[model samples]
Target: MKPELLPLLTCPSCRDGDLTLEAQEEDALGVKTGRLACPTCRTVFPIADYVPSFLPEESGGERWREAWSYKWENVAEQVRYSPEGDEDFERKLNFGNHFSGDFRGKWVLDAGCGSGQDAARMASRGATVVGVDQSRGVYLAQRYNQDTPHADRLHFVRADLFHLPFRPEIFDAIYSNGVLHHTPDTRRAFDAIAPLLKRGGLIGVWVYDRTQYWRLFETFWRPVLSRLPRPALSAFLHAVNRPWHWIYRYRTLMMDKVNPWPESSVARHLADLFSGGQLLYLLTDYHLHLAHRVEDPFIRHHHAFDAYSPTFAWGHDESELFEWFKAQKISVTAISPVRTGLIGVKD
Candidate 1:
């Protein structure tokens, strides 16, 4: 990692000891292989493939981490922001109004940064970004963004959100999107990351909106689905098909299976472009909600698995999110009208 980031790194175990980096391999990109040792707790975090992993082997192999690690690696290619454009990131972050699209000369933390997509986006805009995830997604993300224009400014670390390795008030801004809810306690997860932001720094977060009608259905199905082998479960998600889905004719399950995105591209894109935020959960089995929205049937399957396989999927209303900001002494500035997107500044 960058030498500047070394001083900011603390021991996740002790939360008091500063980490010392011993690089075995180095490049212009930064530390390629190293060991970050904590003198106080004697916790040794390993750096490999240009990414430091604070997650132990046992934790990496846990049920939930396995699911998420698979989830991200599956969609790593599809989720890459096209130079053409990707509006979802802007929509999620409320880009221009909250803090503007420009992030030059800022230090940002992407808490639970799955696949490191958002972190790369911030880095592209000139923010020095540190992305942390407790799963193997960190390695996948490192590989995904390694050759990008802003790779130098991006750092991915595998660490528990509950026990993040950083000094207090180290980040100019912090964001957790569609992540905190998966933790045991959403509020506790928020509390853990809130202290990382500098005073007056902006924090943007998006949690699941409790309004998804299929919430009960998903809750009941997860346990049954999660029990199957991940490969088996993934295969099952890909096989789900409903021919009589779209109102417009000509694009059917068989058509998508043969050739993805391009054949049914026009109408599907139009439908999703207007489908609003809760597009992933409109129908009983997500046959309609995610049909036109996601790029192809492949991505839809991943989204299905992402929604169904998570151990904890808590949904919260705006007031509950507001409470998170209020408790942390953060002032809510701009909130997304569509869902539970909260943009606020620490007081």
Candidate 2:
């Protein structure tokens, strides 16, 4: 962590002020190794590889932390050696489009930054982004972005969303995409980060929407899948992806007939058979909406793992989320055309 970031960090445990840094190694670049000490609370947070660790010993959400940490560690080499080029950049642009103000020269907080991809993108756009994640993905993110032009502007910290190690109203903007829902309580996660944005500062978030079809699937299958051992679950997902890919590859032939739900019993039985009768309802429902857009086998499997691996993956209702923002005294700025992305300004 850099010496400049010391002022922005507060004791997440005690919410105390005047955090003192004990720099074990310092140079022209920054504090290479150090510990942030909170005198009032007597808490010490270690700085490892220029990233501060603020996660508590008994941090809740252990399932997600373990799953993402393992996932990123395995993919770190792939991400660093051969980064996703245009496809990645396009996704970042789509994410940034939800925000209200320009990011240039802004102090942005990327809450739940996975592998630091979006953080690096925002930093490349001239935002000084502080990316925080509770998992070991922070290390992967740091390594992945180490060679970028905006590497100095991007900071990684291992911190939990419920207890971030930053003072209130310190950030000019906050962007959290496809993250909050994975936490045990999405609303609480939002509430925790909402206070960090400066008054009038914008915040953008994209979360899974609780569509009726998605709700039905999640209600029935998510509970069982979430509890499965990692190896078994991964194996199951790999097997599931085979059929998913097959369906996508031949979607042209089968999609039109099944795209519109069958009105007759015979067609319904045929649709069920075509879906392999394994997760019949869920697979058919998902393929109907997304099979045409399925590209990149790696990303398809990655997203499949991401969807079912997390212990808590709650989808939100648009109106309910907007009401929550209103209750927090934040003015709604824009809701994305898809209705999953929401942007609001702190009042």
Number of the top TM-score candidate: 2
Tens digit of per-residue lDDT, candidate 2, span 119-223:
887787788999999889898887777777888788899999998999999999987877888888999999999999999898877777788345566567778
lDDT of 1 by residue, 1-347 (tens): 66778877888878886788999999987888999999987889999987787775454347778777777766444544443224555666655556455789899999988777778878888998999998788887788888899888888888888878889999999988789999888899999999999998999998888886556566667778768877777766655533322332244444456544563466655544354322323221353433455445444555567767677889999999898899999999888764778999999
- Write down the worst ten-residue block by lDDT for model 1: 276-285
Instruction: List candidate 1 segments past 4 Å from native.
Output: 56-61, 75-85, 241-290
* Residue runs of model 2 more than 4 Å from their true location after superposition: 26-29, 75-101, 255-291
- Model 2 residue 31 distance off true place after TM-score fit, in angstroms: 3.4
Instruction: Quote the RMSD, in angstroms, for model 1.
Output: 6.6
What is candidate 2's local distance difference test score?
A: 0.74
Each model's lDDT comes to 0.74, 0.74
TM-score of each: 0.83, 0.85
Backbone clashes per model, in order? Answer: 0, 1
